[model samples]
Target: MFGNVFKGRKVLVTGHTGFKGSWLSLWLTALGAEVIGYSAYFPSTPCNFKVCGLDKHVTHVEGDIGNLNMLTNVFKKYKPEIVFHLAAQPIVRESYRNPKLTFDTNIGGTVNILECIRSTTSVKAAVIITSDKCYRNMEWVWGYKENDILGGDDPYSASKGCAEIICNSYIKSFFSDRKNLPRIATARAGNVIGGGDWAVDRIVPDSVRAFSEGKQVVIRNPNATRPWQHVLEPLSGYLWLAAHLLNSPRLHGEAFNFGPDHKVDKSVAELLTDFSAYWSGKAKCKLVNKRDNRKESMLLKLSCDKALNLLDWSATLPFEDTIRFTAEWYTSYYRGKKGMFDYSMAQIKDYTNKALETNNAWARGVFND
Candidate 1:
């Protein structure tokens, strides 16, 4: 997997307690990397980190990314060879409630990580995880490309856009020299959904909560469309991109979009209907027409052509399989299954098998560069 690049490597994952971060951390460990996780705090109570007992598998550090001193200390102590920066204020609705915190963490925290990478000689490659919302959304029919304008109206989206700008500036100002050791790149992924995600305001988590309690799931912006893919899709791109960066410097400071094919783009209501099919209980949604002060994009999409062309990476799961894999995981967890760590690992294995069946470049350990 990934040309055995991560095997026996020292990998550091920031925000390992969050949804996407936890999954990435576990995958790194499975790849035989010595994984270290740094995070300010767990974003949610029943987070995947705790649910899967990730602490037992990796070195866990608790600190705010905004605190440069603490974050720098972790970098010095760990001396990680590869870094995946996933720490950020990831919620859109919460950003409306606390814009300052969002800016501080998303922008300031990203700066701190770049500074650490700049100073750390042990680090050789990094993948900075941003959002598809980082694009200045025109709500148009077409998907956003890598060179699209960076701007956002909402605080969360704006902060992510600002993070991308900061990363670009750092790359140009500091890491521009060909002699620079740490080759850093940015990844923008579509809305990700999978198991063990219990964050507030996300459609999957909200649906899981409502279904577990036998209540009607509240539908907010049901007609809105998004490029939805399983969590493993983007994670594969990040891993493959990082592996290639270790040997290919031309990709440094570049940005890539990892999203599903255009055929997978679906409305929120459609996602709910497909997700409910695999649910064990009677799953239903109540569409509320109440006015929402917080603004969300009506349509969003990403073009993964860059990733496919440059890294030979593309999303493997279709719409139905994505929903089935997500719904099954949550249902099994809610049914009080033991050893969730093993269960999660099983899902990873299943995803890998699918990738191998399709002969995905990453699964075949084929590096395009």
Candidate 2:
């Protein structure tokens, strides 16, 4: 019930076919928003979008964000008041294989969006999704704040950092006039895991695929640690930020990090253990003891203090709950559960209940009950 912020609003979500995008689209639709989705290539077969039958739920445009003509046409047609950009070459290992693809999609795509925003008049706020790896990680026990240095070890991470830079550049050059230009901000979240993520390199997807396939998950960098959160954690932040942006321009052109509580940080091995537990030990992980050839951060974390202090948002689910929700969704999916769409909506309602019961500010005054 996010303050009825999305009620009757025309919202556009680039990459709406991805795992997190699909979830956000459904949530926004539930809030009475007219959601329009634009995506280039369907990332893979058996994607979350199709699995949930989301194509029937929104006006899905199959096109690339890099194509200014196509993107501008969507803007002109939908006249969306809010936009969320999540399209990217989102894999780090894959980034190493093709840095140019990563750069072109992550950085150039942002440029095209900003260009279209300049030409369009309907967009009032945009929240671009980046990653926690945007920080120049030193592996300290402490978390990285929004002011921390923006750098990355791998191509994927580096591309995100560059994307942040591009956002700042466009905001400074074009959107600096708060009165005339639309509000824009960047969001960085921890390693996101949930159901319907069929990506190759992600731990949750890999574990689920391995367990479902009756194979051992060969986990590389078993000791690497990351701040992990359910996909909802960051999506909630985006929703609130967009709502806030429409109301307050002070947050315009800013960046905020949305991560799990500090206590929730875990290593690869630790999370794999939870997967095995939730799957009745059917999920197995074969740990690789050797160092990874690709450059990667062993420890990555984000400080959510800015979001908590300024936006009054914090993670409502605990680490165990995050894993439980994720595992349960996959289990039910594998079982050929009916009403999977309704089931997904149930998860959102359940999470909202948790937030309301916890007195989360974003939840208290929102939604037309």
Candidate 3:
């Protein structure tokens, strides 16, 4: 797995208390990495980090990414060999409510992380996780590629675009020298769904809340289409890319998209229909044509050709399996299933086996060769 590059490595994951970040940290611990997690605080109640007991497995540090002094001190003290920057205000609707905080945390926080990486000599590789919304969405049917123009009408999307620009600037100005040892890259992933995500305004969590109470879930945009994949899908890409960046200088400052195949694109309605099948309780939804000032992209997708060709990485789960994985997790949690940490780890193992069966470069341990 990941060419065993992560084994015995010192890895720092910012935003470890978040949904995607907790999963990534758990996976790193399984890979035998000495994991250090830094986050401002738990972003939500019933947080994945607490649910999974990650604080026992990794060194957890609570601090804001906006505070350069604290962030820099962590880098200096830990001297991590690899960094995965996932820290940010990650909700779209929340961005609408607090645009200033969104911009400050997403954009300014990224700059602080980059500054730390630039000054810290112990870091060998870093992967900055940005949202797919970073692409200036034209709302066309075609998927966005790596080189596409970046702009966004919404604050969250715009913040991500600004973060990307800042990363590119830092790469070219500070890390571009051939002698520079720190290799940095950015990853853009589409809508990620899996267990342990309890964020506000997301479909999965909202549905879980409603279905548990035998109530109908509200559908805000039933026709909007998105590229949905399991959380492990993108985490695999991030881990693989970080390992490669350590040795492949040409990959420095590159950006790659991790998403499902275009054929897997589904509307919001279709996803709920499939999700309901695996759920045990009465699953129902009510669609309302409510008008709101917060405009979301009607359609968005990403082309992973670069990830496939350059890094030999691609999303491994089919749509059915992705939904099943998510549904099973939430259902089990609701059923009062104990040992969720072990259960989540089992899912990671299952995902790895599936990837190995498909001959994914990272899962087969072939990338190091």
lDDT of 2 by residue, 150-262 (tens): 99878888889998998999899888988764899999986899888898888888888889888888998899888888988889899988888887777898899998888
Q: In lDDT terms, how accurate is model 1?
A: 0.91
Global Cα lDDT for candidate 3: 0.92
Per model, state how many residue pairs clash. 0, 3, 0
Candidate 2, clashing residue pairs?
Answer: 1-367, 3-366, 3-367
Error of 2 at 355 (Å): 0.8
- Report, for every candidate in turn, its global Cα lDDT versus the true structure: 0.91, 0.87, 0.92
Write down the TM-score for model 3. Answer: 0.98
> What's each prediction's TM-score?
0.98, 0.97, 0.98
| Candidate order (lDDT) | 3, 1, 2
| lDDT tens per residue, model 3, 5-42 | 88899999999999999999999999999999999999
Q: Rank the candidates by TM-score, best first.
A: 1, 3, 2
List pairs with backbone clashes in candidate 1: none
Off by over 4 Å in 3: 289-293
